[model samples]
Target chain A: MPITTCVFDAYGTLFDVNAAAAQAADDPDFPRLADLWPAVARDWRRKQLEYTWLRAVADRHCDFWQVTQDGLDWALAAQGLDDPALRARLLALYRQLPTYAEVPAMLAALKARGLTTAILSNGSPDMLNAAVASAGIAPQLDAILSVETVGVFKPHARVYDLVGAQFGCAKDEVLFVSSNGWDAAGAAGYGFRTIWVNRAGDPPDRLYADPHHTLGNLVSIPDLL
Target chain B: MPITTCVFDAYGTLFDVNAAAAQAADDPDFPRLADLWPAVARDWRRKQLEYTWLRAVADRHCDFWQVTQDGLDWALAAQGLDDPALRARLLALYRQLPTYAEVPAMLAALKARGLTTAILSNGSPDMLNAAVASAGIAPQLDAILSVETVGVFKPHARVYDLVGAQFGCAKDEVLFVSSNGWDAAGAAGYGFRTIWVNRAGDPPDRLYADPHHTLGNLVSIPDLL
Candidate 1:
């Protein structure tokens, strides 16, 4: 299958999830919140993925925002934080997370090549739009896809199918790029040629599906495609 | 449904994933590897969950060890640590991970209360055994269930089903506990009473499957149950 379209996962792939949390750490109201940010982000991301998968399996559906909030609440309490105002501020910042330095340029490069570019993420449509708009990268995207459409999360074949269904292509015809190793493996197993954007210098998960390519960041994606 | 039993997630839930890396940091041959351990463990865990779901969706199966190694390799490369010996030592440490201080006494309390105790983990049977044996917590478990039996990972209905299957009870009869908020939600959604062991002081995931209880750590589980 020819790869004519490129789909990216949002959170860790295009957006810096920790950026908002890191910013909030410096807030006057919550000095210790900064040290707690990464763990919060990690817990949120982990919960977000788990919610998507569980809902997918149970055939239940909810927007990513609800899941994101749930994740945040759990994280805050786990950290022994009870300040409602601080929680609210951190979450608001999350809504406007920044894009990684390489993201906009990569998206632009893909667009200049006349290839269809979109975001296939666990994020809700509104969240996706907000992120793309906030990051100033919406103009580079041809479409923004969310798992909400399929009522499932990534690594689920049905969710991946939504991307192919949208683009009018088979799964194999799309290049799925994500900073998440699992999503890369899931997309690969679903038959998409995957590129793992190893942003955090993390490892590839061997047990799932293997990526067709691994890159330091999205900066190298254009050459691979 | 009444919570007759409390099943715990291993790894980050009951074990200190960072302790091994912190210990390895003291090694002269791999000074920086220790610093990289937390990131490595995080990535590996993320991939482990990803692989379990991907394989479950794809109907592809491999043990957790393979997944662990795959995640390690990716983490190593991302951190620019290519030394074979360092990688081996780190991976070996994972098998013999130490339990959290509160684990044994908590398990004893659960057992003392005549409640069933088990481990519902993404770890393969072998890995679980090694961890249990190394931590000297093996005798405390009524059962050590792995996703290997179901050919899937946590947050999956089938993996949760294994718990009921082992105990000859309905899923709702079990009280599933995990440090991972999403897993708590998944298991809760699956009909088990759930507890979120918020060891890192993280927030609730705002899942449809909210836990029956939220705790800072396993130290208080016996009292709650």
Candidate 2:
């Protein structure tokens, strides 16, 4: 089926999840974090994704806000950093994660092509709103759907079902994009045409599902169509 | 109902997942992996659990063997190692992972106390069987259940139901032990009397389910009983 809607994952796909830690490197209170922030950010993002999946499986639903904080807690404790001020700064940066260089133009390109664009993310409404507005892409998005509505995180069929439910389209009519391999796999397995934003050049998962396209960045997404 | 079944997650609970990499360090092929093996094993283990959960959510079930290999693949590439010889050696070591020092005695203690002990794990049947026999814990275990039976990994209520269905007991009558905080939370949320091994001294997760026991090792299990 021809695609009518394009749904993107917010974190890592549109927003740079590493921006908070990268920015924290310059903070005067934790100047030494420059050496460790990269690893901390990697651990934080890993745990964040793991928490969402765990909650989905356990049937214990928490908004992405709680999971994000939980992830930051793990990251800080793992790195032996106990600065409350640093934690607050990192979280504040997370709420307004910077957009990737190509995000605005890519979303605008999709809009110019006469396609409806939305965000189907594990992010909470508040987090998504804060990010979209801060990133200055709010005017380009038709909808910002968070997993909070269904009380489950991504990769779950119900979580992806919201796209069609909100946009009034069939599952096949939505083109899904995500930097996360699992999200791409899940969306494809659910029958959406998936494009994996292979930002890290990671190998594809050996899982049953395969992404229809593996692009390096969001700017290339419009070209895929 | 009185506790009748004692189910354990096999990987980190009874077996040292790190031993495979540690042992591989002794191999003449890859001495350099010694310093990096710890982190590699950690990454491999992290990704393995992730693939299981992601597959469970995506409704794209693959056996844990493939998932294990996928995890290893990610770790290997992440560390810039591209040797097929090293990969083979690691897989061989993993197939017969060494058991934790306290595993046999702990399982025997439970059996002597008249409890039917089993392993309810995300490991495939072949993987679980090989590890059980190679680790010499097979004689003490009444059953070795794999996620293959339900075609979904743990943290899912259906996977936990295998324990009760096999033992003909209520959910509360099962005591589930896992070193993974998320698994402990999921099993506890599903009504098992969960004990988190807490091997790494990690802080408790803020998930809704709280483990009934936070013990340091399997040796402490009998004391808890």
Candidate 3:
């Protein structure tokens, strides 16, 4: 089936999840974080995803914002760094994560192709909105579907159901894109034509399914169409 | 309610998850793996749990043995090592992982107290059986429940339901112990009085619920009574 809708994951796929800590490290105020930010950012993103999956399986549904904070707290504690001000700054930065350099043109190219574009993310509505608005690509998106609507997280089948609910597209008629290998794999298992934008050249996740395509970044996403 | 049943997560809780890799590292035939084994073991365990949670959320059920191999593959590839012989050796070792020092005595202690002792694990029947028989703790355990029965992994509610189905015990009447902080949290959220065996002294997982007790090892488990 031809792709009718192009769906993207919000945090690491469209926005730079590493921006918060990287930005904090660059700021003159947080000198101590200069050497520690990368590890912290990696941990923050890892724990955030882990919490979402754990909560989903455990039937404990919470919004992404709380999960994000919980993740940051764990990341900070792991590093033995306990500065509340740094925590606040890192979270505030996460609220408006900078989009990748090619995000605007990539979304615009998909839109120009007359394909429906949207985001299906574990992010809460407020966080997704803040990110979309900050990146100024809200106009290009037909919908921003958050797992909050279903009170669960990916790679839950219900979370993937949001795409069909919003666009009324068949599973195979959607091109699901995510930077997370497991997310792409889950979408594939759910029967979507999936693309994994493997920015770090990480190995494919050992999951039930594999993405149909693997690209180095979103820059070539439009080309795949 | 008093604890009538004592259920433990088998792999890391009773069995030392690192034993396979650590043992492999000690073998003279694998002298090159001495420095690399620890990171490989950590990645293997992390990916194994991540796959379980992902598969559970995605509704793609596979046996734990496959998950174990997949995890080991990822870990091996991450370290840029590829040897079919080494891979086979690791899987062989995993089938008979050593139980923690205190597991046999602890189960014996629980049995002496007339508490119904059992294992609730993601391990498949054959794997769990192999480990149980190898450890000679088959006589100590009243029941061994695997997620294969439910076709999903923890911390799914259904996985926990197996405990009650087998033991006929109330959630509050069971003491759920796990080395995984998340598993402990999941059990706690499921209404079990949970104990987190924090052997590594890691911080508590930032989940909806927290384990009721934290201990350095399982040796003191009977002391709680």
lDDT score, candidate 1, position A58: 52
Q: Is candidate 2 or candidate 3 better by TM-score?
A: 3
lDDT of 1 by residue, A13-102 (tens): 888888877888888888877678788777766666766666655556788888787777767777787789977997788889998887
Q: Candidate 2 — which residues are off by over 4 angstroms? A: A1-3, A30-35, A170-173, B1-4, B31-36, B83-85
lDDT of 1 at B59: 58
lDDT of 1 by residue, B133-156 (tens): 999988789999988887766666
Worst 10 residues of 1 chain A by lDDT: A200-209
lDDT of 3 by residue, A18-93 (tens): 9999999998888989999999998999899999999887778999999999999999998888999999999999
Clashes per candidate, residues 3 or more apart or on different chains: 21, 0, 0
TM-score of 2: 0.91
Query: What residue pairs clash in candidate 2, if any at all?
Result: none
How should the candidates be ordered by TM-score, best one leading?
3, 2, 1
Report the Cα lDDT for residue A176, model 2. Answer: 95
